[model samples]
Target: METVRIRNPGMYWDIAANLHFPPNFDASKHYPAVVSNHPISSCKEQTSGNIYGAALAKAGFVVIVPDASFQGGSGGEPRWIEDPEQRVKDYRDVIDYLQSLPYVDADRIGILGICGGGGYSIKTAIIDKRIKALVSITGVNFGRLMREGFSNFDPVGALEAMAVQRSAENAGASQRIDIFLPASVEQGKAAGITDIDVLEATDYYRNRCPAEGSGTRMLFSHAAPAMAWDAFAFAETLLTQPMMVVVGDKPGGFGAYRDGMEIYGRAASKNKQMVVVEGWSHYDLYDHPVPTGVALERVVPFLVQHLGEAAVSRVTKPAA
Candidate 1:
């Protein structure tokens, strides 16, 4: 586990990230690579990023988890802006670095994204076929949330508010307006954030595994553009890479009910699978060891199988 900066040439700023090398990792021998994408408003050091990256490394792949531009420690203007296109570009930019490393097999590269990152990874894999395999765990596309808002959320009203926010923002407004998060869980619950997904995540992100630059607020002005984008709009025609989308089995009355099934079906890949962890919600898989374990059970093999035969013969030995 080491912090490394991956420079995105001609971009706003370099992505601050962590590079993980497998145990007994022989720098002499090249290894397959896994690029991880964290949830929105999260960084590489968090439970979602670190846990997944470390787990994959333990499974014998070199993993790099880069903080999205403008989020985490990465650089971009008007901080906290969640530009979907830039987020997608961030993955490709990171891959640009991975492919440069002498120890990374360019053709044997895969990606793993959790939560919102999963949504972006789907898009990234669609156009950037350099990624041989992809895994989206408890995946979410903010396009739906942005366009429609979440459960019990009003898109029309939200759009109306965003229109107002955009005017103030484009005019160089400095004050921050948060559209989703409240200052605290109690406040959020009182403010109509009763959904278990937000509630449970509030507990962890606010308490358990929070870190620097892992702030939970997005600029209100970003609402309109974020809502307009569809994360899986192109999955059917463009997403042909081997894909694995993991969703919680037991519907928690929300996203889990159909969480990633749509994207799974939309993918044009002849090789794709959906894993449903029993009795979990979308957020449950973020840090919950049980479901995370379930996700790993499938993802490890899915990645190994698709990345290349070299990884299969070398690092991914049967867990004894």
Candidate 2:
């Protein structure tokens, strides 16, 4: 994979991306492509690039893993802002970049999104028809997660607080940022946080597989926009692209299992399929060798089958 920058029109920032080329790549020949999106607070070097991008490239597809605006190597101000609208638009910009490449087949493009990105991909495909297929791994619908996860939940109250913060920041108050995960499992345990998803997320992101530029924090002002967003809104009627929803069978942790099933049941695509990896949790599917292997085992064929027969024949066999 090599680094490239894509100009995000109307957004005024260039998106930093890692572009993965297939083995024996022929620049003169057009190839099916996949846009792999990383999770919230993750950089291209995380699962999206190192795992999925590499694997998909090996399977004969040109894959681009981009750092979302305001995070990673991407250019944006008031960094770590997790605005859902911009996130969805970033994918469209990625598609524009992919379509501009001579080696990429514009009509045969697909998207693969992990964690928070899974939700953004769904929202993007709902309105953008260029995405021919979608593969959502451990999908988390952020709006729903926030709505139900909070105790004494009150979106209005949260928004009200955000409004005040925004006003303060506009008048020179310091920007507030919130850490998305704990520093370690021991700290979480001591804090009396028993949720397996939270603990595992801390372990994986904070300790197990930490990466540069993936500081796992977001601007607090982003809450209002994210709280109002819904990744699956109008999906049942508008999401017509071929899709595969992959999630672990485990119960909790950002609601991937529930959201994946919701996506499967709601997507208008007649060719959609869902895979629940037994015994794997949400974070496990992020980089666990066994779980990621299980996911790609199905994901590669799905993309190949949907992208084209030519892609099927070009699929590279895994090395022994």
Candidate 3:
């Protein structure tokens, strides 16, 4: 395994990344590749990106886990701003970098996205046909989610927040994440946001691998573009490749799990499957041993089948 950075001189800037090479990688022999995207407001190792990336490598494909533009190690102005259009493009930009490698089989490339990245991966596959296969582990389209309901189950509230934030920006004021995202567990609980999913997120951003810049903050101006795009809007026509959607046993009544299932049902792919890790919650599927283990087990075989002979990876089961 090695860490590398790809400089995007054309626009969005630098991508900080961790690259995992398959066992006994050879300089002359080309192998299949997979690019995994992390969650929103997350870094490479903060979510399932690192876990899944390394697991894919063990299964014989070279893998990369990257931070998107304007977040984590990637360069962009007005930090932590989310751009749905450009973020989808960022997946392809990572592909551009992967295709440049001498030992990578460009035609056999696959993409994996967990949580927010999952939604973006679907959006990317809709346009960028270079993505041969798609996998979304508990993926939710924030565009659709925010457009429908963001906080207090009010979609109108989210849209209004966007307009207000943009207006504030014009007036020389910037948005702060603390307003919607509590900085502490106590804060979230006090605000009655104590669901298992949010609590998991709080614990995640507050403790494990937190120093890597994983948190729940973003520029409110990021909402406008999100309000405009739909990750699965064209899946019935454009998303024709093999795809997999994995979620845990329980969705915890959060709309994300249901949204993920909807994405699966809406995909146009003749070859698609949804694997559920029984008895696990949404966050359990993120990084916990049992669920992540089940997810990778299903993901490797899916990639191996669709990515063709080059992706017939063989090493061992994913690490817990």
Tens digit of lDDT per residue, candidate 3, span 1-320? 78788875686467778888888887677788898888878778766455788788888888888887887877787788777788887788889999998778878899999888899998898888998999998887878766664544676677687788788878988565433346778888988875677777776677655755564677776666777778888888889989999987676534567877898899999999988778888777777888899888899989998886553333445999
At residue 5, candidate 2 shows an lDDT of: 92
Number of the candidate with higher TM-score, 1 or 2: 2
Considering only N, C-alpha and C atoms within 3 Å, which residue pairs clash in candidate 3? none
Tell me the tens digit of each residue's lDDT in model 2 across 1-320: 68999995576889999999999988877799999999888889988988899999998999999999999999998798988899998999999999998788889999999998999998998999999999999988978876667312777777788889889999999998888777889999999988888899898888878998796888877667888789999988999999999999987757899999998999999899989999989999989999999999999999999897433333445999
The CA lDDT at 105 in model 3 is 80
What's the distance in Å from true for residue 299, model 3? 0.8
Model with the higher lDDT, candidate 1 or 2 = 2
- Please name the candidate that would achieve the greatest lDDT relative to the true structure: 2
Q: Write the per-residue lDDT of candidate 1 for residues 10-99, one digit (tens) a residue.
A: 875788888988888776677899999888888898855568998989988999999888788887777888878888988999999999
Looking at model 2, which ten-residue stretch has the lowest summed lDDT?
308-317
Candidate 3 wrong stretches, greater than 4 Å: 151-157, 178-180, 309-320
Q: What TM-score do all the candidates reach, one by one?
A: 0.90, 0.94, 0.90
Q: Considering only N, C-alpha and C atoms within 3 Å, which residue pairs clash in candidate 2?
A: none
Q: How big is the positional error of residue 253 in model 3, measured in Å on the Cα after superposition? A: 5.7
Give lDDT: candidate 3, residue 215: 45
